[model samples]
Target: MDGRRNGRKASRRVGPPTNRRRRTGAAAPKDALVEAVRQSRAATTGSRVVELMARRALVVAARQLLRQHTDRCTKCGSTFVTHEPAFVHCHYCGRMHRVANASLLEQELFEIRMGLRLAS
Candidate 1:
């Protein structure tokens, strides 16, 4: 009866109990789980921010490429043009210009007529 059971002495470790409640002091299990969830959510939010920045960068790069490869209007000598399937429309001159790279079928079907009269 010298504090020994089955000839094996008890553990000599001197510290608080292994239970989380006793170590944390009055914090419930639900509170600890909630805290862990909050930390994980913060990490997820950080990754989402990085992904959004990457998407914005890609959008900016696409816009730059479009600006570089824009077509100029031959009718009005204007660079501000809207690209269509078979032709490009010039906003400055109000004229629909034919595209040189269009297919022959599209070229014949969508003919570029004279400029439209703009309201003064």
Candidate 2:
């Protein structure tokens, strides 16, 4: 036998292969939520409801990202915070913290979030 121990053939294992369909070699999505929204939009044809829902989902996602990214104030450790293009302001302590210029992706998300807020 070829490379078999003690001249014994390998036993045939009997069981379902573990996650054979799972994309082990495929590149993961940059943002799962964003990719999900894209898929949802793509799955539907021209429909006003779907378009509105997609926008709403994007706004909600951006808000969540902003919240996670700005958890507490640096100056006074306050949780009440707001963000602008250049800085983050702590509402509770009235302190301004300069934000090291956001990435292009971040800026786009912030713009989407702020646009929604400003529109309403």
Candidate 3:
């Protein structure tokens, strides 16, 4: 009787719960856009907005760092070298690589446009 009771308990614990209906409520879908918007707007109209902006800026900087470090040479196993703000040159095969860091490049381009506008 004791062995049978122990075996029953062990089996019950080992497998999924027999009562599947006990889990309530459907899980929410993972939405990156919704989360980003929520985080962006969570703070009221002042320092909170600035802090959120700073956080976003840091995230962008980290992403740029990853891009710079992880870019690999196609011909050899070396990381590509940054030749210009928007270009990298592979040292092994002397291949020029161009990558668009959309936001950063856009900002630089905008600055140049503004300067040209002022000059004109």
Best by TM-score: 2
Comparing 2 and 3 on TM-score, the stronger one: 2
Candidate 2 per-residue C-alpha lDDT over 1-120 given as tens digits, one digit per residue, 9 for 90 to 100: 474767787666568766556557867676986777767854465445532558878876554343334668866888898766655768998876655545656655676787844533
Question: Against the correct fold, how does model 1 do in TM-score?
Answer: 0.26
Query: Across residues 24-99, which tens digit of lDDT does each residue of candidate 1 receive?
Result: 4665789888888778966658754443558888886554332222477656678888876556678999876554
Model 3 CA deviation exceeding 4 Å by range: 1-71, 102-120
* Strongest candidate by lDDT: 2
Model 2, global lDDT: 0.64
Q: Across residues 6-120, which tens digit of lDDT does each residue of candidate 3 receive? A: 4564343565557656667776667966676567745433344333458878777664443442467544757745444554567777865545453555645755765833433
**What TM-score fits each model?**
0.26, 0.27, 0.24
All models: lDDT? 0.62, 0.64, 0.55
**Models ranked on TM-score:** 2, 1, 3
Q: Which stretches of model 2 miss by more than 4 angstroms?
A: 1-69, 102-120
> What is the TM-score of candidate 3?
0.24
